[model samples]
Target: MLDIAKLAGKIPGISHHFQQEMTASSQRLELAKTILQQAQNQQEALIERYQTWRDRLIFSAAMPVEPLDTRITIVPPPHRHSVFATDGSQIAPSHHEIAYCYLINVGRVMLHYGQNLHPLLDSLPEVYYRPEDLYVSRQWGIRTEEWLGYRRSVLEAQCLADMACGWVNPPGAHHEPNLAMVDGSLVYWFLDGLAHDARDLILVPIQEAWEQLKAARIPLMGYLSASRSVEGVNFLRLHNCTFDTPNCIMNCVDVEEQQIPCKVIEPLRDTTLWGENLQPGQRGPLWQSSARILELYDEAQRIYFCYVNVGTEIARIEVPGWVAEDQDLFNQGLGIMLAQVNKGFGYPVALAESHNQAVIRGGDRIRFFALLEQQMIRAGLQNVGTSYKEARKRGSIA
Candidate 1:
């Protein structure tokens, strides 16, 4: 009609442009519907993948570590003397600022003390980055990772040193503990970590400790916490051994069977506690026997490790054989593993657990002493003192 023509004519290309826009809009609407459908499909696929991962992790045991039964024999403590145990845990932010308290008995049974410090890193002074410390924060257009590296080393070394002292005496023992079972190895951190002037300082004290240990002839040994993970599997595989079956369970089998002073895996898992991770599994912290064999999932199987108290300080910490040349790596690795195991398999407590939470079983305190004797022999340390039978004969250390 004339009215429609006139309206179109009044606008410059308006009527024609509006018509084109409406058609384009219709096409866009159809395209949007297709895109939405595709997105929904992708979303469903992702959800399925996640559900599969969670299902695999929840329903399977994936990794099973070796057994630990009779791997350590605790020598029962004599009735005449009191039994003592000690262990410690560090407080950090990852644990929401709680200090972990770890313990082991005079019998050398490795156990966790559930007591902890509140507000973990809360006690530390707010660390300030001093001007002097920032000398290498960065250089013109260059990346400087020095602070992170330096700090990491400092922290690690300090922790190892702290562990050494923590084991030296349990808090408030008034005098030396009848025996202190520490985590990992018993070789005190005398010879570890030194640079330039610090080297001499570290060595001097270490030498003094060595001499003291030598004089006292006290047994210092490292404990290889049982794990089914990479390092543990390799360590045992290196020696070509497994849990000595059936008969060896009640007595100390020859660690000399492998003929090395190294920590051995105690068979702590069996067919019942272990299962394969089918594709429907997710990964977890459980120790695995294979390298490519990532733990589809892991169960924290807390086990009771024994302390063989031969009724004397002369005992074993090193498995009485050739230790790793990489001392730093070995020490750090072992400590972390022990802590993880504690977080997992150790006894569960809901309340504030006491440090001396010990339930004596059998006369097995001697098993701790026996393990100590074996450790001493493995370390190739020649004994010189009056034996425990003779220590009471001499009336020296109780």
Candidate 2:
């Protein structure tokens, strides 16, 4: 390999790109402080303007408002409640390996807080190797690993929904509250990038999960830690800018050129903005997402989110519009999340446990390969060889 030490030594020698950016960093922080102070000064007017936009703005409208409401207090979760979470892990397809197959494993945990703190857990793995699964049409021209990832997302949601629906007692037998949660945003982040044909394959399963959860009224949610989304800041900009046009170039013409726009907010991420204000167990106001992907969702299933102080960090919790619009369910869901965080010490215990179950260790991969190779030999196939590059890496001692 080329000398990494020499490359590291060269990093500090670069000044042209680093110096001006460092200066800009300081300037941005100062601007953010100013924006925060201004937000405090004009809170009422800003909320008013945000409401006006919320009522009139269409899906085609630009920079929709995402208002922040800090006027709230934490409530205790129900004395007897159950929480469920699911997470998935996958071993990507390896061309260098024996079989042209990939494995998707899903882990699920259901925790009951009442009646002696009972817990249930499970893990399931599926492998795919059919010709149709191994290869897609020539138009897409992608690898099997990419397609497997799409399948994996759908499987994770299905696992959670399956666990939720398994609770047959309902209101009569259980005599307790129930909530289901996942580890990320409800919206499929990759959906917007997929072709219509590929998108349909992934969307059907996730939508089926949503339908099952809704029918059961289990109050499903998605929790994201350290989110870098800036939807909240975009809302603040809508309030700041005077331009009525959806495609305003004022920021580009003024801010980039160092001309100082009439009003600027330093482009704060939602997590950062809410981080400053939310106290432990407190949650910010619910904000409807302006993501174009939401248009594909049914009216009741549109996603909304809020930032909550989970003690360790400000995490964004997303829910369907049905959950958001229902006052009782919304409060109870937040209560359940806070309780989960409290029990787990800043994170949800169910999520943590499920992730631990889903993780595939290095040893596990080795064991899997050994089993596959043995099977291949028994089936009268030979020459199971790794790529030359992988072979070198495995044999490298230094």
Candidate 3:
């Protein structure tokens, strides 16, 4: 147990330190805003400069797809439309458990607005105990937890895609404008540093799902709430670099070694930059991601994102290249998102419902292990037993 009195005694010093940090952050924010305004005015020139120096920059930044200062108000969604969303939770394989297995539960939701059809909400849970399922390559040092996480993400996307495809080609011959949403980034950033074969194992399935959505002409979105992404801020730093021919590694140092000149606005995130400027229901310009991992993705599957003010918080909305390139679909998708957030009272209702369906509480985990052990015993597996540490943890002695 924590000692509240001891923690209380340290509060003043912690507060003082936080206050100083906030002061510094405020200064940086001002500088960031100034640089943003300047970039907006010279949008064309900045775009050219970005195009010229993009290959030389070491950090990932946003590549503008629209005018830098563009801010579009959210149009009301169509009277009749559908939104499908999916979220996932997992029970990672634990060494202390009786069984070396993991389970992934994907919550699926379909909501129809201005239609009589009832919302569809359900979950699909799958357990993997086989050696092949439990390990990608034990010899390669790929941890089970990491592989499970990647598999979970892939399952979520695949489930969402399956639902959207079914909705698009229903048996009744009735169709409506629809959007598919996932709770987080679509980019497989976790594939970084993994071997090419491992990357393909994950990306292939996701890309197939993405292809299905695209082939059906269904728009898919990845919603990130309170995003701390610095892609946009990094772009600003690139623009603010004073060197005639900017080379990050060679020219970033100053004589006094105080700070990198271009980093005057250090620590400001894309959220802070947009939250300060974007009004409720307004979205900033679309920007393509410069992540290195995206090189592995098909050209049409590349990610593009924009920041939107959803009244409660700044949200980062990402879409595939196909969606971004299609103006009508992009507009429709954005409007649908805004409407969903408004209806949900500041967050996407579909995502929230799906999350509720996906979340697995601690008590549920305990019960799962207990059930597993019981089933093993019934199967005549007398060797089944939890590790000593796990047994002690269940009922600790005072």
TM-score of each: 0.24, 0.84, 0.96
Give the top-scoring candidate (lDDT).
3
Please list the residue runs of candidate 3 whose C-alpha ends up more than 4 Å from where it truly belongs after superposition: 253-257
Give all candidates' CA lDDT scores.
Answer: 0.29, 0.75, 0.88
Report the candidate with higher TM-score, 1 versus 2.
2
Clashes of each: 58, 0, 0
Residues 56-101, candidate 1, lDDT per residue (tens digit)?
2212221222222112222222222111122222211111111111
lDDT of 3 at 224: 97
Q: What are the per-residue Cα lDDT tens digits for candidate 3 across 1-398?
A: 79898899999999999999999999989888888888887777766777787777667787888888888998888899999999999999889889989999999999998888899999999999998888765655788888888889889989999998988876775467889999889777888888878888889999999899998888999999988799989888767878887677567644343466777886788998888989998999999998888999999999999999999999999999999999888888999999999989989999999999999899988898889989989999877888999888889566
lDDT for model 2: 0.75
Model 3 lDDT, full chain set: 0.88
Q: Which residue pairs in candidate 3 have backbone atoms (N, alpha carbon, C) closer than 3 angstroms, thus clashing?
A: none
The positional error of residue 217 in candidate 1, measured at the CA in angstroms, is: 3.6
The RMSD (Cα, Å) of candidate 3 is 1.7
